[model samples]
Target: MDEGWDTVEVPARGSDFLQLAVADVPAGGKAEWLAGRLRQAIADGRLAVGSRLPPTRVLAAELRVSRGVVTEAYRRLAEDGQVAGRRRGGTVVVAVPFTTTPPPVPDGGSGEGGVPGTGGPGGRGAQGGNEAGGAGSVRDAGSMGAAGSADVAGGLGWPGDPGDLTGPSPRERVGGPGGPYVGQGAGGPGRPYAGRRVDRPAVPRAGQGTPRPPGPYPGQGAAEDGQPYAGEGGGPGGLFGGEPGVEVFDALRAAPAAVDFTPGRPDLTTFPRAAWLRAERTVLAELSAGQLGYGDPRGAPRLRRAVADWLARVRGVRVEPDAVLIVAGTAQALTLLHPVLRADGVDAVAVEEPGSLGARQHLRNGGLATPPVPVDEEGVRVDALRATGARAVLLTPAHQFPTGVVTSGERRRELLEWARDGGLILEDDYDAEHRYDRPPVPALRALLADRVCYLGSVSKLLAPALRIGWLVAPARYRAALVDAKRFNDLGNAVLPQLVLARLMESGELERHLRLVRGRHRRRRDAMIAALAGHLPGARVHGAAAGLHLTVTYASEVPDTEFAAAALAHGVKCQPLSWHRQSPGPPGLVLGYAATPPGVIAEGVALLGRALRELT
Candidate 1:
C-alpha cells in the first residue's frame, strides 16, 4: 500500500511536458510496477542521460496520484542504481542493471538420480521413476509458485512473464471481447501477448500536419524576377544610370607595395585607448535618452561647443557653436561646399599645381573645373592665382601639401587682398599643428574671416577611424551645408561624437599630440639625414615641418620611372608629377611619420640606389 493515499488525489492531466505518468498498480506490487517502467525507459534510449525527473509534487499532480507514490517509485529505482536524486539540479537517471544469465545444467543428470540420456526411448520411463521416488524434491524446484522456480524456469525454454519483465516489455496486448487483459486476435497495434501494456501514442502537434507552398519550377517565368534587373556598364536600369554618380577610392586602395608613403595618414599606434574607454563609460552613464536619439544635423550641442572652443584655442579661429558644422571628415565638407559654389556662378576653382590629387578629383567630380595655380616657396602665388580668372582658389597656407611651405606674411597679405576683392579662398589648414623649427602660423581663415572657409579634422591628430571633422563657412552657405549633411546619413553617429567631446574637454587630446610630434620629428630627421648621405645631389624641400619631406633630383630621370624602380627595390613612394597638373622638375613626396627611424633610413637608402640605377 502507498503512503499518503488519503492526503493527495491523482491529477487528471496526461503526461506531455516532462513525460511523467502514474496509474493504479495491481494488488501487492504497485511500487515495483512503477519502478520497472522508469528503468525500462532508461535502458532503451527514450530517457536520455542527465534528464531531470519531475519533482514528486509536480509528477503527482500530473499523474492524478499521491506524492508518496511517486517518491516510493523513485526510491526503488534509486535502490537499483538506475536513478539518483541530485540537489537543486534535480533527480537524474544514472545507470541501469544488466540482466543475469542462468547457470548451465550438469551433464548426464549428475544433480538428479542416475538415468540414461533423454534422447533414448527409455528416457521417459527412467525420468518418471526418479520423479516418483523424489516427489518433494521435484515439487520444490519445478512447481511455478515454489522457491527457486524462477531460476529453474530461466534454464527452461519458457520466456519470462510479460508483467515480470518491463513495462510495455518488447510487446503489447490489446483488449479483446474477453477482458482488458485479453490479447487481441491476429496482427494489430498490439503485440501477440496477453497482460502486457501498450506504448502511448505520440500526441499530434499543432503545426505538424500543415504543408508548405512549393517553390517555383526551374527555368520558368523570367527566373522569378524580383525587380527589373540590369547588367553591368550603364544601362537605363543600372544602379548608377538612373541617378547621379558617386565616387569610390577603389584604385588607390587596391594597389600593393612594400612601403606605402602616401600622404594623409597619422600614427595610429598612438591612439589613446584608455582615455577613449573612460570617456565611453562616462557618456553611457550620463547620456540622456534624447541625446542618444537622432541628434541635431549641425552636431551634438556638447561636441559643437567643444569644437568651437578648440578652434579658438588652437587654430585662432573665433566662432559661435551654431556656426560649426560637424561633418564626416573634410571629404564631406568638400562635397557640401561643391553645390553652394556651383550655384554661386563659380564654374571653376583654382588649385595648387603640385597639390593633393584627391582634392582635385573631389572638386572635379562635383561638376566644377579645377584650374592649376603655381605654388612657390611662399605658397600659392596670388599674382598667378589672379591670372587664372577664377573666383575661388584653394590654398594650404598653414602647411602646404607636398612642399610643406608656410604662406609668407607678404603673400598672406596679398592673398587676403585678393580675397577682399571678392575671391573665395578655400583654406585647408592641414598639418598646421606640426612644426619643428618655426613658431605657429596663423590660419588664413583668421586673417580674412569673411572670405575663407576653414576645414580641419582629427585624421592627422588621432586616427582616421574616428571620421570626425568640422567646417566653418561664411553665413551665406551655412544652411545649404547643413541640409546636405541632413540628407547624407542623417548626420554622423552620436556616440563617437560624445566620446570625442569628452576627450577634447579633458585635455587628453593635447597630450597625445605632444607625444606623436616628438616621434615624427625624429623620423623626419632620419630621412633627411639619410638623403644627405646617400644622394648628395638631391635637393630636399619641406624638411622643417609636416609628416613627409619632398626631395627633388637634378638628374635627368623621369619621376614616374624613378618611382617604379624604387618600388622594384622594395620601397614605395609617390612621384611629385602625380600631384601636378603643370610640368615641374622631377621629385618624390615621401612620408615618414608612420615608419620608424631605421625603416626610414633603409627606405631612403633604397630610393637612392633606385635613383642611381634609373639615372
Candidate 2:
C-alpha cells in the first residue's frame, strides 16, 4: 500500500504450436480466435510468403500446451491452403486467402459513404428487427432514393460472380431455376439458386468479359496461395477451391522424425555461425544511418560486388556489379521475371521434364503456359524444345532439379543457338556451388549473357531463412526488372546483404562450402548405395553432383502414389510424376544434403520398403 502499485504479470499458456501468449489470444473460443487472428494477419499482409513459422514443439513449449493442439490448428490452416509443410525447411507462410465482407452501416436511409446495406430486397431490417415490408418501406427506400437506386442496381441481383466478371465461357445455362445465367446456372432441383439472370442484359461474345484479374489465377480472385481459380468451365469453386495455396513446406517441417532425407536442403548445422555473427556485428558497427534505412532497389553495391566476385570464382558467371539485383530469393526472381517476359510478348516457356514442380508452377502462375521439354541422360532435349513454340525457357542447367543432369556441351550449344535466334533463358543455377563431381560446368549465363537471366541463392548452400538471392539479367531487360524488384520489396534487407558480402568476400562462404560438400557427398553415396543394395531395379541420375538424386523405378507404380505411400511410411520424397507435364516413367527425387549418412540410409531403406509394398 505504501509503494506505488506494482504490475502483475500473467504467465502465458500456449494454445497454438506457436506458443502464443494467452495475452496474444483471449480466453474462450481460443481456436477460432487464433484462426481468425491468423487469417486477419494474412489478409492484412502481416505475414508474407515464405515466412517460416515457429516449430510446433517450440510454440507448444511456449504456450504450455500439447503439441497436437498447435498442429491441429496448423492443419486447419493447411486444409485451407493457408500454410503448407515443407520437409526439413519447416512451416512457412506461403499464402493467405483474402476474404473481407464490408461492414454494415446504420440506416433507415442508405448511409452516404457508398456502403451497401445488408438488408435484403424488402429492406428487411437487421435480424430480430422488423421486416420493413410495408408500402411505407419502399418510401423509406425512396427517401434515400439516390443511394437505394445504386444499391438496387448493384445489390442482390447476384453481385457479379467474381469468377464470371473476369471471363466468358461457352457452357450455356441450358435450363434451370436461375434461368439463363451463364456460368453459375442452377444445377439440380436441390441446388441453391445463385441469382436470377436478366434475359437480354447485353451478353458479349464468347471471349467477352472483364479482363481476368491479374494473379496466379487469371479471370478469378487470387487464391490464398496466389493462384487463380480454374473458372466455370475449368471446374467447381475457384482455382485452389476458392481458398489459398497450401503451405507445403510448413507441414513437412512440423512432422517429427530423427532422420529426414528431403531434397533441395543444405546442411544448416554447418552454417558459419561465428563468421556470420562477426560479420553481422561488423556491418552493424559500421552501418551508416542511410544504409539502415531503405536501400537501393537493385542491391547494396558492396553485396552486388561481392556476389559478382563470388559467382566468377564459383559458378564462372562474369557480370558487372550494376547488373546484380538482390531479391528475397530465386522464388522472387521468378516472380519478377514472369511479368517482364510476359510483357515482352513471350507467352510460353519450355521447362525440363521431371523438373522442379515449384519452378514450373511459378511460371504458370505468371500467366505463361509451360511446355515440357523432355530430359534425356544428357539434359533437356534441344530438339524437343525446337518443336515447342515457346519463346522462352526456364532451366536448371547447372544441376537440374530431381534429375541432377548437367546440360551437356552439345545441348548447351543448341540452347545458345536457340536463344541467339531470339529465345530467352531463365537459368536457375541452383546448387551449382555444392558439386562433388567433375569440374563445374560454366553457367549458361556466362556463355549467353545477352539471352540469359541467371538466378542463384544461398538457400541450398547456407539457409533458406536468409531469404537472399541475386538475379543477373541481360542489359535490355535489366532496368524494367530492377523496377519490378523495387516495386516488389524495395530491395532485400541491407544488413543481411552486407553480412553476406562479408562472408563471401572474406572466404567464409567458400570455407563453409568446402565443409558441407564432403558431408553431402558421403550422404549422397550412402543413399546411392542403399538404393543399389535394396532397390536393385532403381537407376540413379545426377549423382555425380548436387544435393539430391533422382531414382527411377522400372516398376509400374505411379510416382505420385509412391510418394504418398512413402509419406505413410514416414519417408517423404517427391514423385517424379508431380514434375512432369508429359507422361514418363515413375521415379522419386530424394535430397541427402541435410541428412547424415545414417539417416540417409534409414530414409532410403524406408523408401525401398515403401517401393516393395507398392509393388
Candidate 3:
C-alpha cells in the first residue's frame, strides 16, 4: 500500500491528478505511479529541457499527498538522468528521450550493457531480446511507460514538443530575407522551432514573443538599415505623407530610431529623484485639507509667488504673482492664448521661417493662420514681419530655436516699437537659462509687458514630464487666459505644483540647472569635436549653448532624402526643411543633451559615413 495513503486524505475541494491515473495504480504503487507520469512527460516533451517542475512542498500540498511521496518520486526521476535538482532553480528537465536509433545488438547474447538498470538484455524484447526475470522486467517496463511512444520516433506534433523535422517546418516559410527576421532562414541561428518549447530558442528570452524588427518604416515591413521606410517620396506611412497638414510630431514619435538626435530633448537621466522625493514628502506633510480642493486656475498661490520671485532674480523680468498663470507647458500657453487672441480680432500669427515645426502645428491646430516670416542673423526680420501684415508674432528671442541667434539691440528696439504700435509679441524664452558664453538677454516682455505675452517652462531646466510652466500675460488678457485654463482639465494636478514650488523657492532647481549645464557643456564640446573630425565639410551652428545644434550642408541631395538615408544607416535626426516653410540651405537639427558624449560621437560619425555613401 502507499505509505502515506492512511495519513493523507484528498481534500474535498477537488481531485486534481497528473497524467498518471493514481486511483487505478495497484494499492502501494502511488509513488511509482507519479514517477512514471513524470518520466513520460520528460521523454515525450510535455516538459522542455529548461522547464522547472513545481517545488516538492507545493506539489505535495496540491496533490494532497505526503511531502515524502513527491520527494521520492522526484528522486526516481533524478536517478534515471531525466531531471536534476538545482539549489533554488527547483527540479528541471535536463535531457530528452533516446528517440534516435540505439546501437545494434552485439553478435552474442546481450549481457551487462542492457540499458543500465533495466532487466539486462531480456528487457529489450521489443527490439528482439527475451524476458529474463519478471520482477526486473516489470520495473524496467514501468520506467519507460508512455514515454516509450517517443522512442518509436515518428509523427504527432504535441504541444511544446519538438516534432520530427522530416518535412518542411512552418518556420521555413517565414525564415529568410523575405520574412520579418531578415537574413535568418529555417534552422538558422536565432530562429524558433515550430511547436517547440519557446524557452529552448537562442533568440529573445521566453515570454517576450516574436521580436519586432528595428525601425518601423511606413509601408515596408522591415528594412536592412533598421529605418522604417513609410512610403516612396520619403513620406511616413499611416496619416503621414506629403500632405500640407501632415502631423510630423506623431509620425516621429511612432517610429523611434535607435540612435536618435531629435532636437529639444533634455538629459532626463539627471533628474534629481532624491530631491524630488524629499520635496514631495515635505509638501504632503505640510499640506492642509482645504488645499486639496480645486486650486486657482491661474495656479497655486505658492507656485505663482515662487515663479514671480524666480523670474525677477534669474530672468530680469519683474511681475506680481497675480500676473503669472501656471500652465501645462509652453504648448498649453499657446492653446489658451489662441482663444484670447481671437477675441481681440487677431486671426493670424507670424512665426519665424526656420522656426519650430511643432509650434506651427499647434498654432494651426488651434485654428490660427501662421504666416512665415524670414529669419536672418539679427533674428526675425522686422521688415519681413511688417510686409506679412501679421499684428501678432511668436518669436523665441532668448535662444532662437533650430538656429540660436540672439535678437540684436537694433532688432529689439524695432520689435518694441512694433509691439507699442498695437502689435502683440508672444515671446518664447524657451531655452535661455542654458546659455554658455552668451550674456543674459532681458525678455521682450520685460521691455514691453503690455504687448508681449511671455512663456517659460521647466521643460529644459528640469524634465518635460513634469508638464509645468508659467505664463505672464498682459494685464488686459490675464483673466481671459485664466478662464480658458480653468475649463481645460480643471488646472494642472495640484500636488505636483506644490512640490515644484518647494524646489524653486528652496534653490534646488537652480543647483540642478548648474549641474546639467556642466554635463551639457561637455557633451556639446564632444559633439563639436566629433563633427570637426568626421563631418569636416559640414557647417555647425548654435554650439554655444542649448540642448541641440543645427548643421547645414551644401549637398546636392535634398535634406529630407539625406535624413532618410542617415536613418537607414541606424541614425535618426530631423531635416531642417521640416522646420522651415521658406526654402534655405539643407541642414539637420541634431540634439546632444540626452545622449552621452560617446554615443553622440558614434552617431555623428555614422552620419558622416552615410553622407559620404550618398555622395
Poorly placed runs, candidate 3 (over 4 Å): 1-246
**Alpha carbon RMSD to native, model 2:** 28.9
Q: What lDDT score goes with residue 492 in model 3?
A: 87
Residue 62, model 2: Cα distance from true site in angstroms: 48
Q: Say which candidate scores most in TM-score.
A: 3
Best of the candidates, lDDT: 3
Question: In model 1, how many backbone clashes occur?
Answer: 3
TM-scores of all predicted structures = 0.59, 0.61, 0.62
Tens digits of per-residue lDDT for model 2 on 46-86? 34455455567645544545577668777878888988988
* TM-score of decoy 3: 0.62
Q: Which residue pairs in model 1 clash with each other?
A: 10-64, 10-65, 11-64
Model 2: ten consecutive residues of lowest lDDT = 128-137
As a whole number from 0 to 100, the lDDT of residue 220 in candidate 1 is 12
What does candidate 3's lDDT look like per residue over 1-615, in tens digits?
101112122221111122121222345766897787677555533354654565676456445567898899999988988889888656877876787754322212112232211122222211111111100011111122211111111211222222211112222121222322211213333332112211111233332222332212111233343322223233333212232233345456556567878788888888988889999999999999999998888899989887876665456455667889999999999999988987887766778767887787667656666666655555677876776566789998766777766665556667766876788999998887775433345566645567778999999888889999999988889889989998997888899999999987665775577567667766766676777677765555555457887776545655676687777777778877567554355678899888887888799889889888878
